[model samples]
Target chain A: MAAPMKSVGSKLSVERPAFTTTSFQKKTRSKLVSIPGTRPSVQNGQLIVSTGVTSLDYLLGGGLAVGTLLLIEEDRYDSYSRMILKYFLAEGVVCRHELFVAAVQESPDDILQELPAPILDDIAIHKPVEQHGLPCGPQDSLDSMKIAWRYQNLPKVQSALASSSRFGHYYDVSKTMEPEIRQAANCHRFYFPEHPTQSSPTQSPMLESYSALLKSLQEVIHKGGFDGAAPMTKSRNILRIGLHSLGSALWGDDLCCRDNPRHSHALTTFLYGLRALLRSSLSVAVVTLPSHLIQNRALMGSITRLCDNAISLESFKGSERETNPLYKDYHGLLHVRQVPHLNCLVSELPDRKDLAFKLKRKQFSIERLHLPPDLSETVSRVSRGELAGAAMPGSACGSSTSGNKHLDF
Target chain B: MFTELNSILNITPDNFKQGEFVLISDRHTDGSFLIHHFLSFYLRARCKVCFLGLVQSFSHYCAVSQRLGVSLVQAKEKGQLIFLEGLKESLSVLIPKEPNTGSQALDFLRDPSAGLRSLYEFVRASVSHTGGVEGVEGVEGGVEEWGPPVLLVDDLSVLLSLGVSVGAALDFSHYCRATVCSQLQGSMVMLVRCEAEEEEDDGDEEGPERLLKGLTHQCSLTLQVQGLPTGYCRDIHGQVEVCWRNRHGNGQQMQKKLFQYKVHDKSASFFARGTSSAVL
Candidate 1:
């Protein structure tokens, strides 16, 4: 084992340490793991796992730190949230990490089948090497070829390297997930079926209570080797926990159901317990709650406060944005309500906090929104020579022909 | 075509950032004209646009684009313009015919869940075809790549009339907003029709009002379109009230401004109401 030496005078003195070289190396070095598509950030010596979506990882300041609880408030449709959950799970699968899916509505098998396939770019990486030979022709002299060789060795933009290393994969929604990979992945699924009416208060419950579910989840997580007590393995695997549609009608009653204080209390207790679990273990939990169902703003506020990060989706189809000519190309709006504070040393902090998101077939992106252009400027531009050609035809021809005809009639 | 409207909204192609959700609402049913005008603006600016026509037919939209001097066919050929047949699908659902009874067909037509899902699927397919998300990895030879495409929905209110629940419709809109406006770094424009008066007695108006409220709260910018009285002025076509809360501005306070617009043969102009005639 190679040991790091401390210099004594001009010569290096090989001082025998109390511990073994391997143990010393392990103690000194920070454990860093890479999550696909996102830059790995070290927080208190542990590597933060990537959220799977590159853009999202960028937004969250180099992916979510380990032991962080990310709360996603489900938008009206719940599709976007579901899509995000899939990306998270897919990322876990790709990294050979363990996943715990706490689903309330859909079965785990159905959800797994809908996972997006890993986008492979083997062709993209090989294309550049092939093209590198194209510039040198058979007719080229040795001197010219020598010059080309010199230029080729010069550092090119590292975008190709960057693209090749990107961990995010685009899953085709039309195709189902590959069963071989799905079976190979270490995924634990717990389905919490809703029980609308119970026969008796004293009788054994048909469905697991929120507290029982939280305890069972904790028990599973502890058994998954994420408790941080075991010796660091060469292959560090992250534990991803996803709670789909929490606080929805499927989860007993709505979180804001004041009439059922018992249910609401249980949910609050579960959230607190989940946060505690996240803080102690080498795991990340993504809990999605339907914002619309929780009418009580105070309760919503408390729930959001418990999580490290919170993002809510609001879909507005009102007349204001829908009818405006200026907004003719826009779809819906997105608001980044909260961002978790990172304690790590970051090179460049994400500047844009508030953003609007758009969903395409395979990709989702977030962008900083800007106000529409002033009306007076447009009118002025038309009057100026900028739009002179466009304005002349309308004013000179339309007035002369249509206005005169209208006046004549 | 959009100069007047763009000016009123304080947005120009150069300054308009990608991934903004702009809602255009018309009290009068002239939003189609505005949608056409904006599409022309995008096309003129050399921006790729995906038009989801939920209310108007694709041919009609194309004709309007042509009339506005936008080369729709060329744009389509160049992959700069894409049209999602939302209206066609919605019509198909409305006019379903099979061995099933009339009542059964009617029930299917009125089922908002299926219609909303199909609409969402149609939009996803169109966005994907345009290389919205999944195509980022495949960069070939040094050919000029298309920038993120702007998504334009003709009208979202049509989903409400198609028997979809307000919540589901709002959810779809939210999903679109989260995806197209936030994730794709693409601009999105959705048209919604607002009733001129609040009919408290009518239950039908309540859904639209709720939708309007929800959308208004989320949009960064909102332009209220209203047709001007016929005899008010020969030059002025209509009035638009622009309301927006500057995302970067202090305190998230909403700003409201009004402009009278005149749509001439080729160009449109927006002037401060008092100076409308003089500007024209």
Candidate 2:
């Protein structure tokens, strides 16, 4: 009966098939997750994670891209770079992301156990008062009204809370990490050279190689199901890989000291593979190297090239410039030699090119520098008086005669 | 004069960029006063700051900052300021009842790498939440926007005294620079003492001197502070020679300028040395 009714006017012919429109319409959904302090940015419809420091995310133009490798050239102190690595791993733990820590010098367990505890509680209690200044004046209330008005109309400032809440957590180094949180963290530690060598081997082939380490990392990443297409229902998790002191002797051999072609080749190959692995998956790796150890510039350059970002730290303690007054408050100097554009979608770039770092009891900060306040006015005043006196030495000497006359009376 | 200083440096939200390193060179004893000036400036600007007291105790720095007009206690309570006790770590070994014996303390002092590592970890954890989202939920209307964080290391030369090798110290400096430049997006002001190297050292060539040279080469900007020659000017405390290269512009051109500064009990002022002063 339905076919007979449609035969008169051919309703079926006029009606479009449901699949036709559905197939042509693109179902593009962008899922962006916030890393605590960074602006919410997406790359190819995926979210980027925070570097665990807001200022750093701002410097990075929006935190490290979802899948990129970050290489840090360690300062002689090595503590600062290691601290950064700790922040990376600690953040990973906080975000419930998978962490892979490869340590050459220290035990990975000790490093993990020593991971800083998040200062979320302190932040929660103090941030509101600190941010708004305790609603002291009528002007503040008036400003609040204006902000309310702005919040409704301005998209940039509308979701202030939403944006603020998306910031990373600060940790307390004095406090030990909670057992539950530490246990819940999806972390894997790889300590290179399972067994210590009793004596120096000219070429210990049995010792773990960079290639082997890379292979194991790849396998771990793959096994964790972080590779390939992300699930449709949830966003992809971030995978943080930390390579602590790569050029150090802990990673099989000191690539800096050894001229052996094999050692260099292994490092270069491992870096290449690691970079490739990072690109193909949703992961970020941070490698710390002591540039001082790497005597070969060409070798260091090559290593830097393999990574997406390269940063160098130099302390001024023994430098001729260390006596420079402007550096009086700094712990060290920092140079952002290179930052790769892994994602084409990000438009903002890091504002600073060179920075100084100061390490305090609780925090580390980098700042763009300007010449310290100029005191030319004071100098000029003094100099003007001196010049006037010098130009009229006779007059200056005679002027004292008048004062002496009064004293003589 | 405070406002004038602030304007000259332009350490405001608009001009101050995160990830900058500032090297402050001075006689070890004198720089602390100069550093207090910066601490007050940042704190006044509502910046979260961490002061690593390697040379002085936390209480001492706090007192100094307080005199400079920054209420360290209030700032600390607001979680906007933190004072890390670096001196304690090394001095702890000297305590009679402490677990670390004199030998261990000597060993720790001789090898500052371990202490530096722990200090680094502490700092990383302290500022991790800066601009973070954790406790922002209950914050009501009109949240004040804060400038980037600030870190002040009292004196870097302590590491040298602690027997941190020249290479290792240089490496540490490099690591600090990289960390701040790449991860913190904040500002660091490090104080280094420009003590004349002793002539008696035989094996190493003026270790501190060499280290200073290396740091100067790596730094973008170097400012050297020298006390006014004995009674050159009673009003002037010191002179600062600023050498900087604009990293953004050509990067080749280096600029040098000199400023004279006077420090009072609670305030400091800087003046450009007029040409007349040089002639005199």
Tens digits of per-residue lDDT, candidate 1, B12-102, equal 7666667778888876324456677778877776666788764434544554565577777777766677776553343222222343333
lDDT of 1 by residue, A307-382 (tens): 6677776544543455544434344555555455322111223454445555545555544444444457445532
- Show model 1 residue runs off by greater than 4 Å: A1-39, A42-46, A122-167, A170-174, A194-208, A233-235, A256-262, A316-330, A342-349, A370-409, B1-280
Candidate 2 per-residue C-alpha lDDT over B1-280 given as tens digits, one digit per residue, 9 for 90 to 100 = 1554555555564466667677777641144555766777777866667777654445445545554666787777566777765544433232223344433322334234444554565566665665543123224633344556677777665555444556766776677666665576777777776552223454545334566677787776776777665433435656777776677778588888787776554565678774333334
Top candidate when judged by lDDT against the true structure: 2
Model 2 CA lDDT for position A8: 22
Off by over 4 Å in 2: A1-46, A122-166, A173-176, A195-207, A229-236, A258-262, A317-323, A345-348, A374-409, B1-280
Model 1 DockQ (Cα-based): 0.01
Q: Rate the local accuracy (lDDT) of all candidates.
A: 0.59, 0.59
Poorest 10 consecutive residues of model 1 chain A by lDDT?
A: A1-10
Fraction of native contacts (fnat) of each candidate:
0.00, 0.00
What TM-score applies to chain A of candidate 2? Answer: 0.68
Q: Give DockQ for candidates 1 onward, in order.
A: 0.01, 0.01
